[model samples]
Structure formats: C-alpha cells, structure tokens
Target: MTFLKPVLKSILLTLLIAFTASLNAQTHSKNGMVVSSDKSSSAVGAAILKKGGNAIDAAIATAFSLAVTHPSAGNIGGGGFIVFMNSEGKTTTIDFREKAPLSATNDMYLDQEGKLIDGINHFSAKAIGVPGTVAGLFLAHEKYGKLPWKDLLQPAIDQAKNGFAFNWSLYNAANYFTKEGNTNPFMDSYFRNESGGVTQPDEIWKQTELAETLIRIRDKGRDGFYKGKTAKMIASFMKKNDGIITKKDLAKYEAIERQPIKGSYKGYDIYSMPPPSSGGVALVEMMNLMELADLKTMEFNSSEHLHLVAEAMRRAFADRAEHLGDPDFNLNIPLDKLTSKEFAKKRFQGIDMTRASVSDSTKYGRLYDGENTTHLSTMDKDGNAVSLTYTLEYSFGSQMGSKELGFIFNNEMGDFNPQPGITKSNGQIGTAPNLVEPEKRMLSSMTPTIVGKNGKPYLVIGSPGGRTIINTVFQTVLNVLEFEMPVNKAIEALKIHHQWLPDQIVYEKYLLSPDTKKSLEAKGHTLKERNNMGALMGITYDPEKKIFTGASDSSQPDSGAVGY
Candidate 1:
C-alpha cells in the first residue's frame, strides 16, 4: 500500500506540472478583440475597445502602453509600418520607416580605404536616423481614431509614472544595460538610482522622465516632441554621441501614407505595406510562388513540405535583395510586376524540386534590407482590423538612451547599404538600391499583413525577427489557411527560415528530429539549429459564428490576448 501511494503521488505531481505549463503557454479571451506580445498592453487595448474605441484607437493605446510595459521592442524611439483594414474592406498602409539624417553620406560607415568599419553602422550616435513613431501614431489617431488622442496616451503615461511590477524581461533588460559598451543614461536612470545603485527585479521601475514626455505629447500633439525641448535634447544627445541627427531633422520628420501592396492567395486577398518595407512584395511573391505547388497535398512539417517552402523563401529573398527598395530612391521597383502571378510562376519554374539551390551576393536583380521589431493585432466589434509593427532596430535600441527625452533611439542606418554593389574587404556585398541618401527611407522587412475572404478580414498577422519576419508570417498564414489549423496551433507549429545569402536553413532546435534533419540534408540543404527565430502574434475571426479568436506566440511568456 505504501509503494502504491508513492507511485500515485508521483503521477499527480507530473499531471499538475503539465497542466500548469499548458495554462502558462496560452491565454483565451472570451471576447478575442485584442492581442499583444505583452499582457498589460493587451489589457489596455481591450479596455479601449470596451470603451467604444475603434481598432486604430485600441492599437494606439496599446502602442503607448507597450512603451512602458514591453520596453524591449514596444517603443516611441523607433519607427515602423501600419496596415489597417476597415469593416467596409478598404485598406491603407502607413510608411513610417526611419530616414537617414540630411547630413548622412553614402560612405558614412566606410573607412578611407573604402572598407566597411566594424560596428560603425550599428553603434554610437552616427547610426541614428530620424524617428517616426510619434508622428505616425498621431496621424493614425487624427484620421481614424474615435477616442481623443490624449485619452490614448493617458494610460501609458500613468503606467510609466505609477510603475508596474518588474518582470523577467525587464530584469534581462537591466542585465543588458549593465554590460560594458551597453550603457545608456536613460536606461540607467530607470534601472539604477541617482545614488548609482541598481534596483532588484521585485522593485518598481518608474520612468518619471518618460511619463513627463508622454504628458507633453498628449497636451501639445506631435509638435511636443518634434519642436520643443524634446527635440533640442535629442539634438544635444546626437552632438554628444557623434550622431548626426539635428533639430531640423526632427522638425522635418513626417509619416507618409502609402497605398497598400495587394496580393491574392488561393482565393483570399492579402494586404501589406509597400517599400521601403521589403515585407509586402516578398510576402506577396512567396505566396504566388507557393501557389505553384500543391502544398495541401503534402504532410505538414514533413521534409517534403519544408523543402518546397524553403526554396520559395530563398527565391523570394533573392528577389528582395535584387529588386525591392524605397520608391523615392529607386524609381523602378517593379512592385506590380514583381508580385504578379506570372512573375511568381516564372520564378517558381526555376526551382528544382528534388534539390536545394545556391545563392550569392551578386544574386539580387538590382535591389533591397532586416530589423529587430515588435507587432500586435487588434479587431473591434465592427470588424475593422489593424496589424501594427514597430521597432527600435536592436534590443534596447543602440543600447543608448536619452537622459532628457527619456526614450531610446534606433540604429536604423544599419539597414542601408554602406557600399554600392561592391563586396568590400569584409566579404560583404552592398545593397545599392537601399543605400543611404539625403532624406532617404532605409529599407525594412517589417511586414504587417491582413488576410481576408471576399473583402472581409478573417486574419491579422505579423512578427519581429529581423530578416526572418517574412518567413514567420508566411508559415503562420500557411498553417492556418492551407492546413486548416486553428489560430493557436498555427502560431505553435515549428517554423523554418532560409535567406538566399546564407544558403542555410535555420530551424527551431526543438522542432526537428534526427530523421527530419537527415532527410533534409540528403536533399542538399545546409541545416542549422537555432534556439528560436520569430515572435509571431496573430488574431483570427470566424465570420459564420461572428466570433474573434486571438493568440500570441506561446514562446513569449508575457504574451497576452484579451477580448470584451
């Protein structure tokens, strides 16, 4: 009886742990109207919807809250894109990609010997670009927002001022800040005290300066940051750090609305942002090429399926490096022709089904660009959907914070080609079409997409993984639309990515078995294991039931989904 009792106790403990893990991995919102990578932000957005706010308003509120709650990626210091779809099926794209400062020169990161300088393109003040998040969010609110702009900003301001529970991510953020060459005054002030002591994870992380900054923006509008003391402070920081951003650059920064790049897949319409975002064309072209294969007939995640998808990814990225760029800088982007079905068919025809293909630096047709970014999806009762993707370029965004403005800055200049078409001494080829020029928007791979049936949005998806953004979204959509998986399963499934340059297929380490690797390697693929790749967040709608189902990538511990 004693032995039996011990066995029973062991079974109970194991079952209890498994149940708890399942709960920790996901959240279900009875309402399903809002979802984000952070729980607090999701709650903020959901509350806005409950208060009669529309999708845009909810997204704005969520964005502001994230600046306080999810500081790693949610930011006011960087720039990104917005793809919005109204209930009537009308869609619009906002291009808020950061632009090089007027003083930026093409060879800013190149040495006198015409060689690329180490860390020059990503670190220090020189790498900074003009930010657009504030202007972009303001413009979005002014146009489609139902709630007052100040109302959207208030929650974030309160969160910053009052402080929230210090989380594991916030702990990691502090660790990163304390590392040598990773110091910043703005970040230090939050993590370290005026007495030069660091705070513990259990202590509060209040950002009084940031709260004040948000208050100014709330009261004075966009000009609060662009024209006032905030702008002067940013300029002074740049001058101190050897960065080139000037007050004039901040004053001139504006968020431009561009036409959404449209594509169709298996009878469903796909809408995403256009250049200088490489995501839209790449996603559209990849889907078109995917149509060439009968993916539905193949087993999901099988070597056969993965092989075909990886080939499509490689080809699309090759095209990205060759033909996609900022329209204002490169006038002949051929977006329409590139995303056309016929073009996809031609590209698809070039693939050898049984083996992998080789790719190199000289591969891009003429063109294109990657970044660390964040994403969220929102859907109100009205069926209006918004997929928002924003970034600070790197974690902690240049690892340097502004003491005065209380926000980090982006190392966005790294996205531009340092040299034109030539492989430098460092064995790197420059992307000419995406090269830096005065007022030129650098290339980006931030793809925020909406998938619909008969002009009504059924899915909203996006992710943050530098160049892996395209592949993550592609696989997530494929999982749901092709395999008919539920929204949560779609995000849970293992993802694989292949960019043409590396000629290697990187898969989540936990996803592939020895057999899977051997089978893929037999087909000539260079397989590599990675801890993880993408942070995909999604929301789906079931029209027949008129119900919304939202989810965030289970891999993100803090991800949240909340409805009514």
Candidate 2:
C-alpha cells in the first residue's frame, strides 16, 4: 500500500505535468526565439524560421510538430488561439477554439433527473467537439504565412514517419494513460514499443499512421482532413460508438479571424484572444488593478504584492464567471466596458486590501464571465511575433480517437457547466455563461498573449494549466512589464493563483514563504499548497539592443528554447 501510494503520486504528478506547469524547461537561444513545451517542436519551429519562414510560418510549423511530439497538449484533434503581431506593429488574433457539434444541446450532459452526468461530459464519445486546428492553421497561413503550407507541415510529417527520440514528456503521458486503467485504440498504437515495454529515452519512436495523415493534409489542404477520407472515418467511428458527430458537423467548422482584445499596462500594449476566450478580458481587468497599486515600492514575494495579485485574480475571475461566454451565443457581454480603465477602477475599489473577499461576497449583477492547452512563443528576424496556445482540453483529451485519423479527439465539452442552473455546495450562486449550445464554442482559460512596447513586440507569453492558465500568464506579464525583470527571471519566479471559487489561495509548494502564508492567513485568506502550477513558455525582446531572451520555466526542465 505504501508503494502504491508513491506510484499513485508519481502517476498523478505525471498527469499534472502532462496537463499543466509540470513540463521541463530545456533552454537555449540567441537572436530570434522559439520556446515550447517540447524540444523537438521548438527545434522544428526554429528550423523553419532559419529557412526564411516568418513568425506565422514558424508558429504553424511548431504547432504541427507539437501535434506529433507533444500530443498530450499540442494537438490537431483540438483547437486553440493565436496572437500574432507583424513588423508593422499590427496584431491580429485567430480564434480557432473548438465549437460544439450541431448535434449537441445544452442538456446533453444531463440525465433524466436533470443531474450532471460525469463520464458523459468528460471522456465519453459525447465529449468530442467539431475540431478547428486544420482550418485555423490554413487561415493563419493564408493571411500571414510565408513558407508554403506543405513545407510547414512536412517537418512534422517527416518527424512522425522517420521517428524522433522518445522524450520524458511523452514517456510520462504514456504512463498516465496506461496507469490510469484507461485504454484508447490510438493510445495503444501511439505509445507502444516493438518489445512491449515503455518507449525509452534515446530510442526512436515513429508514428507512421500519423505521418500518412499529415501527408494527406499537406497534399489536400483543409479538405484533406475535414471533408474527405478523414471525415468519413470520424463519422463512422462516432456512429459505431454512440457519438453524435456527423460529417456535416466537421464540414461546417471554420476558424475565425477575430480582432485582438487590446489593453495597456505601464505603456506596454497587450493583445490577446477575445470573447470565447476569456483570457484577454481577465488579463486586462487584473492589469488595470495592478496599474493602480504602487507595486514598485513593494518587494517581490512580499505579502502586500501577493494580496494585491490575489484580490485582482479574485475580482477578474468573478467578472469572468458573471459575463464571459461565446460572444456569438451570449450577445450582450460588455466587451468594451469590462475592459476599460474606469470599470477596472470600479472593480478595484471593491477589494479590501486588509482582508480576503471570499466568493460569497463577490458580486455580479453588472458583470461577465469568460486548458489542457500547450503554448509556444515565436519571433522571426523580421520582427513578426506569435504567441499561440493549443490544446486537447485535457490530458490526452477525451482519451478517444479516430483509428484512421491517428490523432486524439478533444473532450472539450467538459469545459461547459453541466446543468447550467444547478447550485454548487458553496453558498455563491454560480453563473453559467459558458453552458453548451449547438454550434457554440465552450469557454476556455487559455491566454495566448503578446505585449507591445513603443509599437513593437516587447513580450510573448502563454501557458497550459487548465484553470490556472490565466493567472500564470498574468503574473509573468507583471514580472516583466511592471517589475522590470528579465524574461528568464520573469518566468522562473514563484507563482500563485486564486480562481474565485474554491476560496483557497493555491501557491507553489516551498515557493511561497512561511511569512507570506502567515500574513495571508491573518488577512483571512485560506491557503492550499501545490507542487506545481503551469508550463509558462515566453520570450521577451529588447528593441533598443535588438536582443531577445526566451525561457521555458523551471517547472518543466526539458522545455526547449531555440534561436538562430
């Protein structure tokens, strides 16, 4: 039993790393940068940049490579957001986040008694959404890419076919799938070695089937996967497995070009995904509050700083729960006001610096609401920068896949509030701005963001940590833009998060000092310590010196950062 406990702990830690801040940081770089949760993926993106591809080209290439190398979070069977800023200082956001299948309904995850059904909303066939990565990549390339789309995808295709070194991230993900007593046909094919043992480090692991799939996508473009053979294969699997997805659902999925939600903190312009992605709005709200504080006078990790950040997180998250959802679904969200300086000041005044405001006291009549996600930040020599975050929604997503497609499907439907009107055990009456609806995208926490200073990209930041993604990106931005820390130190510093509900401040273990915790407790805040937080990969540019520094975070030591 004692041994089992350690095994279980290791298993959970592996899954946690698989999902969040649990990735390794294998750092390196010089001029332009590419930093991601996977070494091979980063390398591929860097190589693309060296080959004369622009930032969008590198980003698209990196995304596809991650689909093969870091399948746990980097995915094609899923969807995500991209924030791109070109040399002209023009920044655009591509919102390719997954949408609900037309066959889906608000109550699909509820039973006869209107109770929330767990498995059905999570790893079951009903959990899959109409995917958007293929469409998203194509559209981003059409608008901003330089290298041929086939050229961008070929690296990933060759890597999958010719094989790459089996790394620890993939090793742990494989363990997580197997140890958890779950089995997917795709997992069986993807994770296995010829001798039936776990694939070892330094050993070459190949995905011949996945390579073939990528080849098809390269040869045919968007129609390759969504409208033809791949579509038929997915529809057939759904039909046999009690899933509701149809060829029509796949055919209708389109990646949208959305205006970046813009904000400023201390002279740096922030550009992030809007609406369906609540990240930018929450970030703006928090930064607005931080802007009001005299954080410069306070020491890093001081109780005052923690209190300010926690309060901001609490308020912004509260606002997110109240007002955020798919903009196309909930049409009345105060998109402009909620992100305005005046609104942030109003929200800031409600916070009492001396005491913790629990969820029950958080108000919402005026407001709004808004990750198994992998993130990477790339910058080309031409000054074009990209901050992209993509995901399968959970570790290995629905733990389901189309046998013929060679990719896992996202269990994104779990993101929506099941039984939207149901009350939680907590006293706060929960809001359901993110409930499922036919063709409506589920709300996500992914905060793929870019910061511009003096009309040029100053920082590129994002992460994968489910509920923690927003705060992770938020704190990192503050570290650089406000505290004036270098890119490496900004990502390596201790981090904390408080997401309105739960009412407990989640601090990184051994990172938050005892004195700080004591002060927070005295301030009426409950505390919970966690071993990890999120894999925050970022790069910062010093325009004056023409220098760029990239960091993959200390949480995941093998995270690779490459530049040429």
Model 1 deviation from native, Cα RMSD in Å: 4.0
lDDT per residue for candidate 1 within 282-353, as digits (tens), equals 899889988889876887788888988998888888788777778988998889888999988788878887
Give the residue spans of candidate 1 off by over 4 A: 1-32, 179-186, 193-196, 365-371, 423-429
Report lDDT per candidate. Answer: 0.83, 0.84
TM-score of each: 0.93, 0.92
lDDT comparing candidate 1 with the true structure: 0.83
Q: Which candidate wins on TM-score?
A: 1
Candidate 1 residue 341 C-alpha distance from true site, Å:
0.7
Question: What 10-residue stretch in candidate 2 is worst by lDDT?
Answer: 361-370
